[model samples]
Target: MNLGELEKAALQYFWSHEEADAKQVHAYFETKRGGSLNTIQSTLDRLFKKGLLKREKQGYAYVYRQAMSKDAFIGELVADVTKDFFKPTENALHAAFTSMSSSLSDDELSELETLIEQQRNNARSE
Candidate 1:
């Protein structure tokens, strides 16, 4: 998700729905985010060119779909971000996490703990 705002919005639109023409995407922003049609179309086209989206011609318009599943995309992002974030030290990450953890719900903290335990177990097994 290290993309520009319009690119992120366009990707989110693709994530929640099936392939759509640029016009459909533009219409959504026109109502929801209130951006111009050209902006939406340019974002979609840029995403297609960047290999983040699949595009196919349907009669006159090109319909676009996400190239990868949202889960996969997020997993890659998390891995990349963690690699960068934890490059300094575990203590730094811990301090940052502690500061941010207050904003998370109890269920979210529990789930994160479970995931951390799972990763630790997997690492030990490996």
Candidate 2:
């Protein structure tokens, strides 16, 4: 499922904070996005089914945690966006990477370089 704004926001919130129950998430939405408790609960369920979250039993309620980090989530989104929106061409990929790289911080850029190096090493080994 494509993560619309609300779902994406919920994931972002979960990534920054520790695990939370549906009621707690609903309260967060009430303060910010103003959704009902049931709505938040439904959203959480949807996220769980989408493999974005893992839920654990917490007494009468279930506490949910992120299944992936924010960076991993963004990477998946970027890959999906690339496949769905861009043409299958080297130039398109190059342009997409260039556009995205300009917004990265120095630390993020360093991390990306490390990832690319690892990818290259993997390719050589293969």
Candidate 3:
């Protein structure tokens, strides 16, 4: 899936903030990056349509929140890319992690290892 610059920015905004209406989101971006409120509303609507955001109509306007966490979104993107080239076998997954680990710092690798251990434990319990 391709994301435009504004779309990516909107996703990041939703990830950071719990929920926001179009005006609130537009105000947040105004000082940092200038954009019209209509543009921000369009971006939010696009994200909602893409299923990256959840929205509820609150009286006069809709308030939006992220449909998934940032990590979940990244994981989905990784899975999407990996599925195109590999069948998702254990060896393929291991190779992918090993290659990706080359750029990670020691602390990040440790955190990754912890997450993997948690997943392993969860799988065992299930």
Q: Tell me, what's the RMSD of every candidate? A: 4.3, 3.6, 2.0
Deviation from native of the Cα of residue 43 in model 3, angstroms: 0.5
The TM-score, computed over Cα atoms with residue i paired to residue i, of candidate 2 is 0.72
Error of 3 at 65 (Å): 0.4
Q: Which stretches of candidate 2 lie over 4 Å from their true place?
A: 85-95, 102-126
lDDT of 2 by residue, 1-126 (tens): 477788888898899888999998888789886878888888899999999999999799989999999888887777777777767764556667899899999999999999999999999999
TM-scores of all models?
Answer: 0.65, 0.72, 0.88
How far residue 68's Cα lies from its native spot in candidate 3, in Å, is 0.2
Tens-digit lDDT track for model 1 on 1-126? 458988988889999988899899988888877988788888988898877899999998899999988877876776566666665546555656687789999999999899889999999999
lDDT of 3 by residue, 1-126 (tens): 888999999999988999999999999999999999999999999999999999999999999999999999998898777777876564566667889999999999999999999999999999
Candidate 1: regions farther than 4 A off:
85-126
lDDT of model 1, residue 79:
58
- Distance from true location, Cα of 109 in model 2, Å: 5.8
